[model samples]
Target: MTDKSEYKDSFRCGYVAVLGRPNVGKSTLMNHILGQKVSITSRKPQTTRHRVLGIYTDDDAQILFVDTPGIHRKEARSINRYMNRAASSSMADVDVLLFVVDGTQWTDDDELVLEKLSHAKGKKVLFVNKVDKLADKEEVLPHIAHITEQCDFDAVFPGSALRGHNLDELTKTLKQWLPEGDLFYPEDYITDRSERFMAAELIREKLMRSLGEEIPYSSTVEIEQFKFNDKGILTISGLILVERSGQKAIIIGKGGQRLKQIGRDARIEMEELFDSKVFLELWVKVKDGWADDERALKSLGYDDYR
Candidate 1:
């Protein structure tokens, strides 16, 4: 029988950063791995604007997964620069760098992501995401081989974040790479971010999904007020910042129907997440060029995670 000391030798705990270009499913992978929605997801690129920490703890390991904004070449806006910096800085001192990419398609943004990964100090693992979309499973080998030649990744894994394929194997490999240490968070804890932060993200996600493609990128969400009553009912007031008066009109829609829909959808999700009744008030305010202004971005909570 194995001794307790021997068992202790197998324990591991450390931070793992999930990185990739926009729309590569980094957030999806983290959310699926943790079995909770700590980060928001959308069909649109750059849906994640901040660095989100998803904590996973078990008997053998505690992996703090850092879900970073997708790195891209777009630094025209201050928010874009902030996101790139957030993703880049998260790789520092991390135990594992899990670089995810789309198996169906690879773009110049992906190459940019790889360039950033090259400079990271952590042990790297290449995740070829969305293999479930492949016409034939055998196509993955050549694709994996092609990426493996680009860098010195410790391991190359192929899986679908949406379908939950090979995630267990990826988790096992990540645990093996972690150093032996005690858990950084309690067993039941799943994220380091506050519920207030999550409420803002959830509202932003609903807005992103509801708005047209042209309007989503020019918007951001901020939680102005969050309070819980004695009856366990949570009240949240959020401000959605847009870059133009035109965008604000679009968000508000005819007779305020669009804004009401956004609030209703976001409130439903918040209730389920907090496990209590929730009242969410959403207001769309135009802050011209806020995404381009570093000071305004900081005020809206874009600079806090850094």
Candidate 2:
């Protein structure tokens, strides 16, 4: 008598890029799909500064969803151009393109996004995210009609990524579109980013949440320490690099209130995500014109990571 183990054949696998205008909830959709925060999101446009790869897998398929930076009509700095390229880079050889749109409005930004998609040659799914916030789903029809008229997408789905509305349908639709192949990532894996990367993003999310409009844009968080303790604690130390001394003062606040607030918010989220007590340490450093500095951007994992 002999015991035998079961073996399965190749499963469905493919890459899908989640692209859209900023604040359209692309990152939120991605976080929902992966069941974790793989990307930082904010109400501000261009929140995502890089192409974040989040892997979702079940018994049948593994979908590598790339949450890219929001596209804007600008050629300002090298990073802006890099972010723009990050959006299109996912299209080169992906099985699907999840083109997300804000359900709140169908203004020129939506049209501009559609125009970008028109040039992409891939199977596309139109996702009108934030449907729960919409007073009338019918209001999205004109925008949908306008986009569908321009490009022949495979399907259109109205969903609330925040509220988890119609997400099962969206997942099911994606499952159907994936091609049969070996799983790109193991079933247990969720994202390709490392612990340090996630910590940096968490810090960035706090900056986006706590800081004023100009502050987040002028600062970048860099992780300098990441270590796990035997007592189930994770310690992360990072520096907030700002573009100016004035920005540093703003981040530190009048009596270090703002910095403390950001640290508290970030540490709380980090603890939850890591499932351990997180000791987050952040410092502010002024590096003038770091945003436009090629070396600085490269070190921050922008063009190099791309």
Candidate 3:
């Protein structure tokens, strides 16, 4: 066998940022890679509002992967401002940048990402995501080449985030790019976020998934309590805050049936995540245009000063 020092020189460690436009499966990809729910997933745009870090480690390398919000060009608004800044700030002091894009097209939105990636300090690897829909995987090469021409990157990878396809290679490549360094987090560890935050996010995800777009976008979930017992029982109370009383009625539904459904679904997933029985209570309250309120935004953890 090679000497211990020689072995150390061959190992790698670094940070990889998963970035893309809204609903491009960036959150799904992060959850899949980390094999846990570090970020929330939704069909809606700008689902992730914070910088989520997921750690991956093996004998040959260690990776600190940052899951960023969907990279979108936006106008004045509290939500947009925070999402944009959260995603952008993760770019600093990173070893590599993984600029994720939907593989199906080469829209103007993609060009905007290219512009942002152009200014990033480190090397990049472009991933063409959502490839499961392709009639033939080979069809994306032309688009890949087009992006490659515009942005200089170490390599271009094509994969489906929804499926497990190409993830092994992508992970291997990302590990290879990093220089030798100490592990950032323990091998068994996966994410930096707390269970409380994740519980609230799961409630939000259920709302977004079960309810229609109009209500989901106008919604936010806050956790009031999260406690568990050795008997494998967990209790979580969440506030489903909406923008209007009309929306609140829609959320509560007939005899509070809709709220029950949302809580049921969220609790099931929480049980699976925590490996315990969960008692989830959901309350719907109209925040009355709190989306525009700076204090409401700050309380929800969208404080841009981070």
- Candidate with the greatest lDDT versus the true structure: 1
| After superposition, candidate 3 runs with Cα above 4 Å error | 1-10, 136-138, 229-232
Best by TM-score: 1
Candidate 1, residue 298: CA error in Å? Answer: 1.0
Backbone clashes, each candidate: 0, 0, 0
lDDT for each residue of candidate 3 in 1-306, tens digit (9 for 90 to 100):
223343355777688888777777888777777776778887777677778888776678778889887777763567776777788788888889998888767666567778888888887999888888888877798888888888899978788887967888888888888877666666667787788988988888888888877888778888999998687689888998999999999989999998899888888889888888898888988887767677888988777436
> Sort by TM-score, best first: what order?
1, 2, 3
lDDT score at residue 170, model 3, on the 0-100 scale:
88
Residue 238, candidate 2: how far off, in angstroms? Answer: 0.5
| lDDT of candidate 1 over 166-246, digit per residue (tens) | 999999999999998766777788998999999989988988899888799999888889999898889899999898899
Q: What TM-score do all the candidates reach, one by one?
A: 0.95, 0.92, 0.92
RMSD of each: 3.0, 3.1, 3.2
TM-score of 3: 0.92
Off by over 4 Å in 1: 1-9
Residue 79, model 2: Cα distance from true site in angstroms: 2.2
lDDT of 3: 0.81
lDDT of each prediction vs. the true structure?
Answer: 0.88, 0.82, 0.81
